[model samples]
Target: MTKCRECGKILPQEQRIDICLDCSRKKIQKRFRDDPELKDVFKKTIEELRKPENVKKMAEDTYRIVNAINEMRDGR
Candidate 1:
């Protein structure tokens, strides 16, 4: 067994996550289950972003969205 790096909780040997696993799962499941519009937006965005011609733009957009999400979480 080892300790989780983020929360400093004891975890089983097979569980190698750094952060709070249960908290991450709960937030992921809740977002996927409850955010229909966001899901559709992601689906469409993925399709558009997958094209070879869109690679640079996709990277830029990915960074922007990730930074925005991080900021939102930090604010909370």
Candidate 2:
């Protein structure tokens, strides 16, 4: 059986990642609660990413990266 890396809870077979969902949520919550600077930066980044132009750019960048990876794999 798979186990959570942080809490040692037995993970379901279908779960791929080492950390369980509960531990991931707790880690993110603790990080935001403990680090004000990171919290602010994360909030700002979220706001920026929510903008329409930024969203489009990010999508385009992701598409480009995927195509590049595909090309490299085909070339191999």
Candidate 2 lDDT tens digits, 1-76: 8788789999767655566656765654565675455566556655776688776444333334334444644776
What would the per-residue lDDT of candidate 1 be over residues 1-76, giving only the tens digit for each residue? 6765546877655554443455444443455476454556555766887899976555345434444544655776
Model 1 sits at a Cα RMSD from the real structure of: 8.6
Model 2: colliding residue pairs: none
Question: Which structure among the candidates has the greatest lDDT?
Answer: 2
Clashes of 1: 0
- Which candidate achieves the best TM-score against the true structure? 2
Candidate 1 Cα misplacement greater than 4 A, ranges: 1-36, 67-76
After superposition, candidate 2 runs with Cα above 4 Å error: 36-76
Deviation of model 2 at 74, angstroms:
35
